[model samples]
Target: MSIIIIGAGEVGYNVARKLSQERKDIIVIDKDEEKVERVAETLDVQAIHGSGSSISVLKEAGIERAEILIAATNSDEVNMVSCLVAGVQAIVPVKIARIRDPEYASNEKILGKEKLDIDLVINTDQEMVNSLLRILDIPGARDVVDFAEGRIRIASFMVEPGNPVAGKSLAELRKDYSNLELVVVAIYRDHRVIIPRGKDRLKERDLVYVLGESAAISQFLASFRDRKGVAPPTKVMIFGGGNVSLLLAKALEERGVATKVIEPDIERCQYLAQQLDKAIVLKGDFTSHDLLEEEHVREMDAFIALTEDEDRNILLALLAKTMGARRVIASINRVSFAPLAYQTGVDVVVSPPLLAVNRILQYIRKGKILNVAILPEEQAEVIETVAMETSDIIERPLKDLKLPSGILIGAILREGQVIIPRGESVILPGDKVTLVASSAAIPQLEKFLMVKLEYW
Candidate 1:
C-alpha cells in the first residue's frame, strides 16, 4: 500500500521505518532539511523536504494514490492542516494525526467526519498517562496491555530468583496451578524472544508475557512478588511539570493518591499548582539532593521522571531508585534509550513513540481485529480479532488447523465467557480470538485469517 507520512520526527520516523520494513511504498515529508536527510539516509522510504500542510506538497508526494496519510508533526496545527489538505485533495482512506492539545482532541465537532475526517487521533500525553495508570495498577509489572475492555490483560513480569515457578515448565505450572486460568504466551531471555511451548521452562530474570482474565493474571503475578507483599502505590513523586506529568498527576489525585510534582521552572510550577487540586507543586530541580531529601523521596511509593531531557529522566529515576523508592518510572522518548534505561535499574520505562505506533498499527491492520499490542523489542504481537463465518479457522479443532509456527492461540472470548484454548478447543465464528505470534509469523497469520476465496 502507498503510505505518506508527514513529519520526520521520532514518531513519524519510527512509523515510516516499521512500514518500510514491511516493504510498503512510503513517502515521508518534513520541512526540516536535516530530518529529511536523516530519513533518506537511514530508511528505505522516499523522503521529501516540504511542508505537509501545503496542497502542492501533498500532490507532489502522490497523495492521489496514497492509501494512508499520517500527520505526526510536533505542532498540532500542522498535523490538523495536513489531514485537512489530504481529505480535500484525495480523501485518503485512513488519515491519522498526532494531536497534542487535549482541547482539539476532545472536540468531536472539530475533528469529526464532517470536519477534518481524521480516522484516528493520537494524543501522546494521554497515551502515556493511560500506560502509567495501567503499570501502577499492578505493582511490579514491567508492562501491561489490556484487551476486551480490560477483561483480558497481557502482563509482563520478570521472574525473580526465588520465584516458585522460575524453573518449572509450562506443562508443570498448569498441572500445579490448574485452577488458575492463564497462558504463558512468550518469554524474553538473553536478548532473544521465545514463543514458548508446553515444555519450555521459565528461568530467573526471564521476562514472560501472560494472558488471561484480569483477576487470574493478578493472582499469577502475586506469586512473583516477595513474601512481604507489595501494595499499590499510595504516594507518587513526579519530576517535571510537562503535559504528561500533569495528566498523570490529575489521574492520581482522582484515585486519592498522594502526589507531588517537582519542576525546575518557576512559571511551570505555578501553572501546575493552579491546575492541580491535591498534588503539591514544588519549584526545585529534581537533581538537587537536598530538595529530594527534604521531600522524603525514600518514603515515596513511586518516583516518576517525565522531563523532556531523556538523560535527566534516566539519571533522576536511577537516583530515586537508589534513594529507596519502591518503584521508579521514567518517560523515555527515544526508543533506543528504553532498554538502556531499563538496564540501569528503572522499574518501568514508558516510550511515547512506541505507544503511538502500536495504536496506529492496530488501526491499520485488516480483518475484524479489535486490538493489537506489539511486545517489547518487537518480539511478538498479541492480536484480538473476531472470527468470520467464511474464515477457515472456524468450525474445527485448533490442533487440526495447522497454525503457523511461532504462533499461539492464547485466549478465546465467546459471548461473555473466556476460553483458554487446548488441542480439542474449537473456535466458532464471531468469537474474539486472541493470538500471540512472533514478529516473523504476522504475515502468515494475517493470510490465515482471510476469508476463503470460494466464499467470495
Candidate 2:
C-alpha cells in the first residue's frame, strides 16, 4: 500500500522509517528542505519539500492513489489542515493527523467526519499523560501498555540483585509461583532481546517484560521487588509547568495525592497555581540544590522531571535521586538519548515519541487489531485482537493453534474476565486474545487476525 506522510519530525520520521523498512511504498512531504534531504539520505523513500496542506503538494506526493495519509507535522494547524485537504483532494482510506493542542483534540465536532474527516487523531501530550499515570499506578514499572480495555497489561521492569526471581528459570518461576498467573513475554539482556524459554534464566539488570491481568501482574511483581514493605507514593513532585505536568497534576489531585510542581518561569507557575486546586506550584529551578533542599524535595515520595528539555530533565531527576527521593522519573523524547537515560539509573524513563508512534501505527496495522504495543528497541510486539467467529483458528484449542515460531498467546479476555490461557483453552467469537510475538512474526499475525472476506 502507498502512504503519504507530512512532516519529518520524530513521530512522522519514525513511522516512515518503520514503514520503509517493511518495503512499503512511502512518500514523505515537508516544507523544510533539510528535513526532506535527511529523510531521503537516511531511508529509501521519496521526500518532497512543500507545504503538506497544499493541493499541489498532495498531488506531487501521489496522494490520489495513496492508501494512507499521515499529517504529523509539528504544527497542529498544519497537520489538521493537511488532513482536511487530503480528505477533499484524495481518496486516501486512512487519514491520521497528529494534533497536540487540547483545544482541538478534546473537541469532537471539530475533528468529526463533517469537519476534518480524520480517521484517527494522535495527541502526543495526552498520550504521555496517560503513560505517566499508568507508570505512577504501577510503581517500579518503567513502561506499561494496556489491552482489551485494560483487562490485560504488559509491563517492563528492570531486575535487581537479590530479587527472588532474578536468577530463576521460566519453569522454576511457574512451579514456585503457580498461584500467580503471569507470563514472561520477552527479556532484554544487555540491550539484546531474548524470547524466554523454560530453561533460560533471568539475570540481574535484565529488563523483564511481563503480561497478565492487571491485578495479577501486580501480585507477581511482589517476588522481585525490594521495597522492604514500603508503598509507592502518596506525595509526588513534578518539575515543569508544561501541558503534560498540567494533566498529571489534575489526575494526582483527583486521587488526593499531595502534589507539587516546580517551574522556573513565575508566570507559568502562577498559571499552574490557578489551574490546580490541590497541587502546590513552586517557582524555582529544581537543578539548584539549595532550592530543592528548601522545598524539602528529599521528603517527597516521588520526583518526576517533565520539562521539554531532555538534558535538564535528566539532570534534575538525577539530583532528586541523589537528594534521597524515594523514586525518580524523567521524560526523554529522543530515541538516541533513551539508553543514556536508562544508564543514568533513573527509576523510570518515559519516551513520548515511542508512545505516540505505537498509538499511530495501530491504524495502519492489518486485522481487527484492538491494540498494538511495540516494545522498546522494536524487539517484539504485544498485540490484542478480537477473534472473529468465522476465523479458522477461533474454535481450536490453544495448544493446537498453528502460531509462528516466535509468537505466544499471553492472555485472553472474555466478557469482563481475564483468562491465562492453558493448552486446553478455546477462544470464542467475542473474546479478545492478546499475543506476544517477535518482529518477524507480525506479518503472519496480521494475516491470521485479519478475516478474509472470501471466508464466508
Top-lDDT candidate index: 1
Q: How far out, in Å, is residue 367 in model 2?
A: 0.5
**Model 2, runs deviating above 4 Å:** 226-230, 451-456
Worst window of 10 by summed lDDT in candidate 1: 447-456
Off by over 4 Å in 1: 227-229, 452-456
Model 1, span 1-456: residue lDDT tens: 899999999999999988788788999999999999999999999999999999999999999999999999999999999999899889689999999999999989989998998889999999999989999988889899888888888999888778888899999998887787789999999988898999999999998899988878877787668743466789999999999999999999999999999999999999999999999999888558788889999999899999998899999999988888889998887788877998888989899999999898876666667788888777788898888777776888988987889889999888878888899999987888888988888787767665531133
Which residue pairs clash within candidate 2?
none
- For candidate 1, report its TM-score: 0.97
TM values, all candidates: 0.97, 0.96
Local error of candidate 2 at residue 129 (angstroms)? 1.0
Q: Each candidate's lDDT (Cα)?
A: 0.88, 0.84
Candidate 2 local Cα displacement, residue 125, angstroms: 1.2
Clashes of 1: 0
